[model samples]
Target chain A: DVKVTQSSRYLVKRTGEKVFLECVQDMDHENMFWYRQDPGLGLRLIYFSYDVKMKEKGDIPEGYSVSREKKERFSLILESASTNQTSMYLCASSFRESPLHFGNGTRLTVT
Target chain B: AQSVAQPEDQVNVAEGNPLTVKCTYSVSGNPYLFWYVQYPNRGLQFLLKYITGDNLVKGSYGFEAEFNKSQTSFHLKKPSALVSDSALYFCAVTPLFKAAGNKLTFGGGTRVLVKP
Candidate 1:
């Protein structure tokens, strides 16, 4: 079975604070993704990494950045968090054309 | 651009009753469609996918989806509903030609409520 782990399940931060959400996958998948889920909006992609040091912006990538220094780990960074950034963040990893395996998700609260 | 739509926001059904959750999609070229289920406070779990071949694809936990090219729909169905089957369901689509990376566009999700 594939396992995707998120560093934090829940987090709270003040406005303008820098926040990091870490994800690690044991399956050695080549593609990792970050998404935010909001009520009524579903899940919207924030960023994705296809390989180490290679990142691509998703539908809503504003105020967010990603790091893929290693194949097993992917991190989502909020350079300066805002209240609007508060939401459930999900991390997923997958091989080409394969179904994504997802972490439990990190619910971020930016006050 | 690829997109998926879940028409119903919520679906309520009694246990042992047949259930259907609607999903439709639009994309350039062939469509690679998928259905996922999310329990409370859990990440989305892959339920079924329609890559090609059989129009009716069976998946995990007794769930299945039928792909209709004419209608551009991939609706999920089950013979009988169980209270445990209640969850938030999502439909997603990725263009087949763009298979380099698995970039999927998801629907808003439908909350299924099964009453015992």
Candidate 2:
């Protein structure tokens, strides 16, 4: 089974602080993705990486950035965390454009 | 450009009764459709997908989906609803909505409520 692990299950940060959410996959999938889930909004893609150091912006990339320095790890970075950035963040990986396996998710709260 | 629409915000059903969650999509090329379930405070889990081939595809937890190409719909179904089945259900289509890429475009989501 594919296992995707997020660095933190829950996190709290103050407004204007920077935050990082890490994700690692054991399957060495080529594609990695970051998404945020909100009530009535579902899962909206923030960023995705197809290969090492290769990144692409998703629908809601306004306040997010991503890093894929290695095939197994993907990190999401918030330049300046704001209250509006508080949401459940999910990471996913796939071998290609195939079915994705998702991490448990990190609930971020910005105060 | 590709997009997916989940029509209902919520679906209520009695335990042991049949259930259905509707989804429709638009894409320039053949679309890869998927259904995911999210329990409270948890990430989305893959329920099933319709890539190509048979219209009816079965998946985990006694769930199944039918892909109707003519109607541009792929709806999730279950024979009997269980109390544990209450969760948020999302339908996704790839590539992203209004983009010619490989990312998935998820519907706003549908909350399923199974009453006892």
Candidate 3:
């Protein structure tokens, strides 16, 4: 079983502050993704990395960035946290041809 | 680009009753379909996927999905509903959606509420 772990279950940040959400996968899967879930907007992809040092912008990548310095870890960075950015963030990893294995998720609140 | 849609925002069902959640998708080529369930505050869980062999695929938790190419739909179904089955359901598509061979596209999602 693949275990995708997010560093925090809940986080609160002050507006305009920078926030970092970390994720690590036990399985050395090459693909890692960050997504935000909102009430009516389902899941919107933020960023994804297919390999260390490689990253791709997803549908909604503005105000966000990502890092993949190590194969097992992927990090999402919010340059400046805003109340509009508060939402449940999910981390997932997957191998080619397989389904994504997800972490429980981190609920970030920007106050 | 590939896209998925869950027509209904919510589906209500009674325990022991058949449960169905509708899903439809559009893709550039052959579609690889998927169903996922998300419990409150949890990440989405893979339910079942339709590749090719059979139009119907069975997955964890006694859940199954049937693929209808003509209708461009893949609907999730269960013979019996349990209170625990209540959750948010999402449908996805890939080539782009597959294992993320590319980008994965998802539907808006449908919330299932099983009443006693």
Candidate 4:
């Protein structure tokens, strides 16, 4: 079984604060992704890493950055958090061409 | 670019009745389609996937999906609905070609409600 773990289940941050959302995967998968889920938007990709230190922007990557210094870990960084960035953040990892295994998700509330 | 669409925003069904959640997709090459269910406050859980082989694929929790190349659709189905089945369902797609990368383009999602 594959396990993806997100560091926080719920988070609250003030505006302009630098927030870090961390994720780690037990399986040695090559792909990891960060997504934000809103009521009508479903899950929009924020960022993804194909390999350690290799990152790619997804559809909505403007307000975020990502780090993949290690294969097992992927971190999403909000350089300066805002209320609009609040959503249910999910971390997922998968082997090449496989279905993604996801963490429980972190509900972020930016105030 | 690959894309997926779940036409209905929500689907309501009575318990013990059959349920279907529709999904359609577009991609330049062969598509790798998937269905996932997200429970309240939880991340999405994989339900089924269609890579190749038989068009009808069965997955966890008695859910199944049919892949139709001509229609470019992969609609999810279940024999009977349960209250526990109420959740948000998302359809996602990725191109079969490696050049497209492993990124999945997801649909807006369909909220399933199973009423007793």
Output the number of the DockQ-best candidate.
1
Best-to-worst order by DockQ is 1, 3, 4, 2
Query: Which pairs of residues clash in candidate 4, taking residues 3 or more apart in a chain or in different chains?
Result: none
Candidates in descending lDDT order = 1, 4, 3, 2
Clashing pairs in 2: none
Which has the higher TM-score value, candidate number 2 or candidate number 4?
4
lDDT of 2 at A73: 99
Scanning candidate 3 chain A in windows of ten residues, the lowest lDDT window is A37-46
Scored against the native two-chain complex, candidate 4 gets a DockQ of: 0.64
lDDT of 2 by residue, A40-77 (tens): 88889999988999999998999888889999999999
B1-116, model 2: which lDDT tens digit per residue? 66778989999999999999999999877878899998987778999987779999999999999999899999999999999999999999884232323488899999999999
Q: Candidate 3 on A1-111: residue-level lDDT in tens? A: 889999999999999999999999999899999999988778888999889999999999999999999999999999999999999999999987688898999999999
Clashing pairs in 3: B93-B97, B94-B97, B94-B98
Worst 10 residues of 4 chain A by lDDT: A36-45
What is the TM-score (0 to 1) of candidate 1? 0.99
Best candidate according to lDDT: 1
In candidate 4, position B107 carries an lDDT of 95
Off by over 4 Å in 1: none
Q: Tell me the tens digit of each residue's lDDT in model 3 across B76-110.
A: 99999999999999998885334455467889899
RMSD of each: 0.6, 2.2, 1.4, 1.3
Task: Point to the candidate with the largest TM-score.
Answer: 1
